[model samples]
Target chain A: MPGVCASSTQSPLEGKVSKVKWPTYLSLSLVAMILGVLLVFQFRVVRYIEQGVSLGRVQELTVELRQLEKEKLKLAAEASDLSAKLQQAGQGQAEAEKALEGELEKARLLAGLVPVTGPGVEVTLDNPPANRGWATSLYVIRDEDLLRVVNELRGAGAEAISINGQRIVATSEIRWAAPFINVNLTRLVPPYHILAIGNPGNLRSALEIPGGLVEYLQELGVQVKIQAHDRLTVPGYNRPLEFRYAKPVVKE
Target chain B: MWLGVWLTLLGLILGVIVGLNIPMVLTKAHAKYLSVAVLAALDSVFGGVRAAMEEHFDHTIFLSGFFANALLAAGLAYIGERLGIDLYLAAVVAFGVRLFQNLAIIRRHLVRGIKRG
Candidate 1:
């Protein structure tokens, strides 16, 4: 304020225009102005150092870890309770059954009969809706296109995969039957979102590698979005398993 | 004070506003050098102000000191990095000490001038 109305605040020494010049004022004020901007930047740097993850981000991450820990505790308690019951009922047979039960649980997970949740990647595939022109179906997503993506995900060590909520197991088939793609006998509507549970880095790189399925789909006018998640839940397979002709061969 | 000093300040404010809105910002990696440069600028500004009050302000000396302090502080920090040491700490302390000393002298000069008047 004082500097703005120069004459009113001008001291006796500064009144000598012979001593004070335009350059001094210009340089000083310019330096002060630059200092203001640098101050703001320095403030930002200090803030980032103090809190790399800003407020409201830590809670959600802790929630996922908490859920996983709860499940682990539940499993351990069940194991301990079962062993105690078996000890009361008399002994070695139940011990074997307990181990077998653990194995069965793992197999059921592999068969996609149980709901699973973990860190994973979600992929969404769609066709550009605005460009629905003549012979556009030729450029649309096909069963083979989906198959290629599934194949790539599997190769990248994906433990579980689902297309449009349909889990892909050993017997699941991806097929094209005129105007729609089928996964496990269920027709899918685009945009087809595929969720794969695996190392996110590995899964992303598998699909996004140069000239890979995602790029190929893009070339065919199919839009693809791949995102990694800290906690992704895939629905359990709803279809029943039935076997009549095929029988399990037993060891002699 | 120069008549156009306000214009220089206005230009600086406008430049910062426009540039920052354009999302031009120093990243975290550049913070180390930026902090040192800021300290150097602060020292130069104080020194300049003291010289101005004593009626011996020289543009060449002021500008040269400004750039030299910034570059030398940055260079010391770089050399420290190469030698696996914290040489920038020296710049910070040296500048900090000079800053307060300059501030005290400026304050004493102001007090004497006010009492005389």
Candidate 2:
């Protein structure tokens, strides 16, 4: 360590202190101070340089991402427009096909290529001839059985269905009339006639679906059979559509 | 480097997990088929766009290869899902194929394009 003392005399201090020692100490301290100042400035310079590089890269990536996102949005808009057009075209084609199918079916019936559709199958269920006890009355078809058959026929795409010639409309009720069941307002006895009008193949398969209508009915010892005809029309149910009770209240 | 390869694999896995969880992110009524179709279409379009952009703008082998691999995996996954095939199998095969395909593309780009540059 060099002391801060210095002589003001013009005389050479060489005698008190050697020339090399004082100058050497002064030069070394000056060098160290200069280096300290440079280091502090260097730290700031390095920090700014790093920030510049990082920000430039971030900006570049951000621009690239924005452009990519814009392109994606534009392409998506175009795709949605195309999809909408396709949906409209598909719907139009489906409606036209349905109309043509109906007309063709009618024409086939007129030509005798299809059977006239009328009162569907009549199923009459009677107590087992040997099981003459009142307990055998339980053998009558239950609500679940009727529901299963109706559901199966619906799944098979039956256009119009009537149980025992009673037209099953959207609101038709099928329930037990205490000794016999009334399907679509028509009272039917055991050995029930289920008149379903649809594709015979599909209808039969639907009716015979495993663990479906057929399986349930058979478990109850009810006899089941299907007869297909080209046209079997059931009389329309007389229930009126009720919506007055469901009207929304207006908030003024 | 093998590190790059591993990173790429990790990215793909993350992308898939995130993709599967997107419905949770975006609540909307979307049929699975429709979403899958859209995903496939976007993948194809992105692959093509990336290729075109690379060829026209960057002309870089690595960037183009990444885009191509991403597109292939997305496309195969979509097709498998649509056909009712195992989606995970499709995705796995897609990853391997994409890696090899991209490597080949990179080799070609280096040999045919970068050598002169």
Candidate 3:
């Protein structure tokens, strides 16, 4: 059957080659060409898509967060039960101990160990959607971008600051962990929601300073949204903190 | 046999050139569907070649199959995206499996032809 093409003219009939019909080659060639084009196009498109945090990764983290929340609830219930037992045992405590309890409550509020609510400003940040579909990492929001915003807010007398609902305390950290940022040792995804308790106008103005954090981010193709709110509540620091080496000095 | 292989190579090179010169911009979303469509197209092309070798070549069926399969797969992918399901994966798997099957058939034909020749 394959020899039928050998009888035709322009068959390159010098050899016993299995000559297939020319139509087959022509059609396959066109399709192969389309395939080649798509291969390169898909390759370039994948590179751009992978440049940002993928949806699958975010979903994985969300699953982890849900599991951790369940464990946290279980732990919190156990802690409360233990605290109740201790309070029952410490009934009729001395006046000195009662006074110390009051001091501890004041310390907790000052140390950001409890949630605080007041008039403040909220700053949200995310990289602007690519306009040309070129490099994305170059214009993305970095850890330093977030730090600059936080610093500017604090400089403007923000009493309490929370990033993505993770309270910022003396030991809190805001740093980069490629493809995502970390706050208080917890991974935070964009768009970063930064809430600060302070004079709303002052906090907003601090970020709005010419060539300031907000402006700098905006220039880098980062979407920066700032709004002053009459009331904003910053979450409390939930992670346990332990001081092992530091001790108070005894005063003579 | 060698002429057909050379034509395929030439077509691929020409395709790459045209694809690069073309001003079409493929976003990340469209890129996914393109990959699946490419698989479908390759599958149809191989199926056509196989049919021709078996003495039943029909350009009408081959062309319709190529375009219709790609469009159907792409449409399925779009629906999957809106529904928040990875429905494109089904198209990917089905086309991918058929593509490999067709390639294997072509390889057997080439090997048998070489032995006979």
Best by DockQ: 3
Q: Compute the lDDT of residue A137 as modeled in candidate 3.
A: 47
lDDT of 2 by residue, A1-252 (tens): 112111111112222322223333333333233323333333344444555545567789999999999999999999999999999999999999999999998764443343345433333333444455655455666656777777877787766665665667655788877776766566677656666666777888777779876666667667676665555555554455456668888999
Docking class of 2: incorrect
lDDT of 1 by residue, A1-252 (tens): 222221111223433323546676666556566766666667667666666653356667788789989999999999999989978777777877998999999889978999899988999988655555655555678888888888999999888899999999878999998778888899897899999999999999999999888888888778899999988988889898878888999989
TM-score for candidate 1, please give it.
0.43
DockQ of each: 0.08, 0.01, 0.16
- Interface RMS deviation of candidate 3: 8.9
TM per candidate = 0.43, 0.31, 0.41
If you superpose only chain B onto the true chain B, what TM-score does each candidate give? Answer: 0.83, 0.32, 0.85
Q: What is the full ranking by DockQ, best candidate first?
A: 3, 1, 2
Q: Write the per-residue lDDT of candidate 3 for residues A1-252, one digit (tens) a residue.
A: 222311111122222333466886787677678777876666666766778567788789999999999999999999999999888768747666888899999899999999999999889998787667665545777899888888999999999999999999999888999888999999998898999999988998888989787787888889899988999899898888888898899999
Instruction: Give each prediction's root-mean-square deviation over alpha carbons.
Output: 35.4, 35.8, 38.7
lDDT order of candidates, top first? 3, 1, 2
Of the candidates numbered 2 and 3, which has the greater TM-score value?
Answer: 3
Q: What is the C-alpha lDDT profile of model 3 across B1-117, one tens digit per residue?
A: 688779988988988887776666676668888877777777777776666555555554565677777777788898999999999999899878877776787789889999999
